[model samples]
Target: MALRETDPPEVGGYRIEDRLGSGGMGVVYLARSASGRRLALKVVHAQYADDDEFRTRFRREVAAARQVSGAFTAPVVDADADAPRPWMATLYIPGEDLGTHVRRHGPLPLPKVRELAAGLAEALRDIHRAGMVHRDLKPANVMLAEDGPRVIDFGISRATEFAAQEVLTQTGRVMGTPPYMSPEQFSSPQDVGPAADVFSLGSVVAYAATGHGPFDSPSPYETAVRVVDGDAELDDVPPELLPFIRLCLEKHPKSRPTPDELLLLLRDGHVPEPRPLPTPAAEETRPVRRPKRRRRLWLATALGAALLTAVTATTVAVTGGDETAPGDLPTGWQAWHKSSKDPSVDKEPVGPSNPFNRCAATGRSLVCAGDDVMATRFALADGRNTWARPIDETADDLGASTGGTIIAAHSGRVYVYGADDRPIGHDGMSLTRYTVQALEAESGKVIWKTVTGDGPAASEPGTDSIAIPAGVVATYGDESQYYALLGADDGKVRWKRPLPDPDEQPCMLRGAAGHAYLICTLYTGSDITGTSVTQLAPTTGRPSWTVKAKGGDLDLVGQTDGRLVLVGWTGNHRTVTLINAKSHVLTTVRLSPAQPEEASVHLVDRTLYFILEGGSVRAVDPSTGRQLWKTDSTVERSSRPTASGTRLYLASPSGRLAAIDLRTGKVVATSPGRDDGTLLDTPSYVNAPPVLVGDALYVAYGRRSVYTVDVRDL
Candidate 1:
């Protein structure tokens, strides 16, 4: 690629030539030093240069790269962290990245695969000997030099010393490409040793031999899931190499072969002659199957969008096949769906190109609200729209202007908070009058409306603004210190109270076990402090119990058997905290060191499950705080998981559905995701979690439509 005008002409006394590539953190350029030595200069992005944490991380990467001394690895030449844009230079091998090579030349032969493995093993041995772990070792980070291969990119690498754990965790960054990451990287990143690099090397070797990763998926999240719960796609791989690669791809890091062991096996010539394996049946490899009705509907929609009907199915599946068992899908129902992009609704402009649609289920009816659309109900049996109403023009304009939406439909009532910006008094200042309106869920008729005094602007634009449960409707800003529980029937304030500490802000509010609990976190400027969990009486706004958490951010999973189960994170390590509301006895169990800041935790019965950003799901026992099982679902940006019976359901933003067995943590069934042909710069709206009512599951598709699935068929 040619160097762009914005790129620096020179960096760190190196003469810039052309661009090598760009990554999440910075851009790499092909440059030459003053002495005429070719170099790869990596200049940190301007935006990241201003971040103190990123700067420190960049410094560590430079330091780690300098420590490594190996023939099959790129060596650091020079670096200047104090420069205007921190930059590092390394010996630029004259070759292409492994990914590019594979994409252009197809899969490599067995001999080439063997050679690549040996080179990577030697490189890893050198890196491990230097007391460093190359946390990220994807294909794109490996260079196919003329002699062999050179491992590069230490941006997320860490020193093996004890102090490195603290330094790396302090940044709270979950680093690595999902498809190439080890299971431990997703479940316990900070504790990852040299074995993680071996796992990545196996993935790279698989890609080299098959032109595809062992756990390839449409998104990184889904790929991560496969890395954890699914099997390697080794049917196309050489039969003799399958066993060697499988050992490297084991879920348990300790079970994987060390670099030294791999070298020994390669040197011993224990690998057999390459032999072709029988092609697996399509049914065996393809897990997600679309019903005939879904196929026809999708074809029609794709034709409307002038796109070919290309459906990509998931290759991973649970050990158990999708069967009509006692606890599977409900009876007397078949899977049915309706696209929100129907001709009637597609023509209506919803202000934001991609707006997030929120949905709630009552009985068999699903009510959804978003953007220009107020609230619409659909029959869960057939996905038929019962009623559709346009939001009030006054509220619509305000929501569009501020990029906010009114959340509605809960407990048989639709609630909307609208703003009436009317100027009052001589000063000509517009008084932002916030109105709380309640509408009939079935008919969409305005039942009652009340004016709530000027409240803080909604903390989150879409999903986190309102919570309606049982007899009360609660509203709070994402970071507001004040919260109010309104009567569900009349839209009147039942009880409003300030959080325990005025300086502390509430991050989440939920109603569980007939009680409303507020989780607040203390913030000193931009840094976070200890979190406070308080149980409040909905009727009287009285506190029942309050637990002050440690320094990490806290997420309230839910109450299990009268115990509050929460996941807390400090640095990169996550811990499960169980608090007994009555006894006020708090037990904090430190989990393996992993990045849990961006994970969503849910409590079903006595088990708490964590869905991480990288698409790994782990089930933990709150009583013992022991992780029962961890599986990868490869569904990126997935909705919060919902459980029923012994099955757990999860949905991604792209409309992919995955069902896991609660007892085994294996994916039992999956649905081919719906990919509407709309390409927007940003997601239209936040994804709503799958709502499981009886034998049916309801999912909000992007910000456009809602669909129902009969669990029995799954």
Candidate 2:
């Protein structure tokens, strides 16, 4: 029966205020208690109120509501299961429901979706832990309260006290809203439990993240079919959160994560915080800037004033607002005075200049190499222009320095720079400009340079041979010959050694400290395999030891402290190997078993981070050989992850930066990406790692925009 203005004299002592909204089974009214507490009174229709079976179910719902009623759920204010119009009065929740919010705002950002997922999981845990099952859970039953979310209207909810007839009736009857029902709820509702609620929560979160439900269909019948027999439509969900939700929606309810388990997962993923609870006044109104009456008057007067001023003030004197000014110097960042934009193009700047190219940091300075220019150095703190000199213009390959002095050989030149990046000099045979260069630390002078035997070169900087030290430079070439000696200054031979086979492949440099490290793959002349790290002393130029590392394609980042970090990828298995430079002790930690793909390994102090081909990232501790955290960036396949202090940053190819709290493996915040969506769509092969100078993250995109995001704000 429709609730009319004069239908009820009173409902459990409080008079009906007005019809709030109505659904198929009942009419909800805005009501108040004698003490003036607001409530939503759901009075059952007369037709259903007399049905004994329906009354029993509603009684059970009242019991369930009383059990779980708290801050996270709608508390029961009053109810009369035996009344003529069986009614339930729940403390009114103020705010748009999930469905209404999605309809109004479109899809929420990933961060908000994450918070919703976590909050719902916690809510479900509370309900299930109390031994109740909200079989008819759906968006309409959820109130987006300010403090978090509050589950409401538990009319068909039940506990574990099940009779066969009750189960069968609840199962066969059209119990839940079809659009939000779970598979079991549709095909066999009797089997539904806490997991069914989880399934519905999944749908709610999906709808919130992407304006459609997980099993959306052209028709309700099709959507039910998909929920029962097909895969969920999760295409729009963030890749990082997809795996967790998939586990929640598993076909077998038992296979799905329990509410507690879901909480743990969300905790690990660092889900965002729940929105604060709304005060009573806040709930009564959508956020407004002014009093309703005043706003209308102000609007009329503003329009009248605009009309009078428009004609007389034709020439508008616009004042510039200095809102976009660069922020204060971040920690560890040096105060810089030069223009942050590209440097002057007209000045005949001296030295090897590398501008508009990728760069990596050493200690506190930035060392970058570029085309037609020698590698240059700049104070990472302040972006101060350091000394730059000329390297062979034809050189294409550039390797980031480890300590501060050694430059890996590229196409032709191996240019060396002092702490200030001033070119000391160059040395080599006929390929002086072509060989790699090594300079001393104290003086801007060339130490030693090498040009190996001329032939079809394997890869530039052949395998990782050169180790530039205080007074010595080590070189290992294709001929299996090793040389460790003082350069032009000392003119003293330190050591010399040769390998077993001079014709073997040139060693791929793995890493180095006082000893030069190389990963040599011993071919059995069959299938590709058998790779080992060869360690040779820098002073003696002789084999110190060899440790078995993971076989396959591996990128060896230089030695930090005493550990040699190697990112090894073999077919479907990805492993990171850490070898102690002194003891050659091998420790291997497997990352994703996806595949051996193009990847990069970057070390920030103690933690080692790697990026897979599809743009997923894994952080590992080399010392313990333990996996820290892994996240699918979904940006671009080639975008690299960068780390500073304890914060790790990953920017999707579209310029969305996901800042992860390293200690907890949780995503703290994400920036709304590029303003121009189409620009990020332009494919570019050159991928750049985020430069973390301190609290500020500087990254360049496309050709013109160089954006900086404050990590502290996130």
Candidate 3:
């Protein structure tokens, strides 16, 4: 029978509107704040009202919630965590919990999956930064609002006291929901922290993706034992998201990333806000005053029931295999052939020398440039190094720069060089400081060279230059110069404009709206010192328009048709924007946080593909702000994306290249993923983006070197 809504005997001053829900330790009701704001008010059970110990615990819980309130979490409105009956109030978000959402709608769509993962990760980062742990992070605690996800039900354990006791066994032991508990939670609750929440996040991701938990054992005992001693059963987790999930579920807390670390690893765009520093106080508190014996028994029994026998069997069958082996690719997957790391150097680059590889495709080959590394090319048809030349590495070397225009893929081979002969060396010394050179793709000979500044600053190479079909060169300058120069074939500067120096961070020359634009990070010395973007004229260095972008650095993907697309970070959220340079228009699409799950972002022809940190891919239209379609593939990092006609290609880090149906986002073919953990701590990665040349896919794997995968299946 249903319990009818009734007035609460009393609460500070507001009257209870209706009973929202009831737990073993307290009854939650819809209540109003002094100003009439709606709140979920939880009042302790009558039996525990007389216990001083319970009140103390409730106070602690309230204190914890107050310390860590922000966008990702439901903010506290009012609370009496230490009241005689132990009551607290929080803003009531309107949405079903994750469990109900999934039960009603089935698994989430791929884009939604990525959004959830990113949002949850950011949320967890906020929770942890406050120096507290959500000991009980589960699907039931998440609310899926239309704007995004909001984490709720914090500090319930302390307010109810029964929450902890209810989950304990008859042996006077405490336990969590078996499927959602982390190994640390089971083996040592006292030792658990943010990482424990990560483990629960893994379970949440698994449940959202495949309708089952990672360790859904047949019985509560079995589930507990598996969580403490067995491998995570992740059959339904897509291959791409596997690594991210595994990292979160690492048995060793040290192996797991902090919330901030996870945010950095999962995002490919902008962050809007700096995660506020966690308050010195704890963020989560457990109620300790309620009855222990009954609570424990009830918790055990509920967990046991939730792990139905059929569910466990299906879960085991799906994720039973050991998927750590290298060169293993999911069926129908394609390969991407570019790498962010150097496969030949053996040792990873010393610093974050280059966080990402700049890529562009024309005709049938892929071209790439990186920090301190000269422009290099690999045949898209086969994984073979076409040519690699060393560029300048000094702080201000213009000759070392290769922005993006090295080889003109669309037109015939042409060399880029300085029109007048100026001494290439710095200070005219014997040290031949080379000028910027553009070489012929097939011949590998310099077609053009442009001399830059002098001294150590001049020793470094400038970014890639753009070679428009009209023979105009667009290149960015160092800190001293803001205007990216556009030189005629005769080598005379057409125009120059000063760029903004915000944080004085590295700036990139990107093309959007069929014109050249500048993207840089402006630090305001405030809470948000993250990335921001501004559009500029290619020749004049004038602001066409500017919008605040997210991220520490920015990269230019390409102008599809004419829309200027850029990716940046704002806090933990990656904001992707499509700007119309001609109309001075912009459309910003923010990705939801990647939580226990993982995701990647790729822009193809104005269609944004959010590759879940898992291997599932969802295609969305940035213009209309709608999801087009999605597909699932093998899980792996270091995979680069390439497009041929209407089809997209993906290369596994393990050596497999795959062809995907662009319209449907489905993998039509695949190769293998290389396993290389030698550089887990190092920057060198075997698998990166694959280069597509004609029908071949070039793959670079960490420690394993580079290889090729054919696209016959596609």
- Highest lDDT against the true fold, candidate: 1
Indicate whether candidate 1 or candidate 2 has the larger TM-score.
1
Candidate 3 lDDT score at position 534: 65
TM-score of each: 0.47, 0.39, 0.40
Worst 10 residues of 1 by lDDT: 290-299
Per-model CA lDDT versus the true structure: 0.62, 0.52, 0.52
Error of 3 at 56 (Å): 92
| lDDT tens digits by residue: candidate 1, 26-99 | 78999998888999888877776676666676677677767888488889989887788788888999988999
- State, as a TM-score between 0 and 1, how close model 3 is to the true structure: 0.40
Q: What is candidate 1's TM-score against the reference?
A: 0.47
Rank candidates by TM-score, best first. Answer: 1, 3, 2
> What digit string (tens of lDDT, one per residue) describes model 3 on residues 167-257?
2221112435668987666544556667788888878877888777777643343355346434565655665455456666765554565
Q: Using lDDT as the measure, name the better of candidate 1 and candidate 2.
A: 1
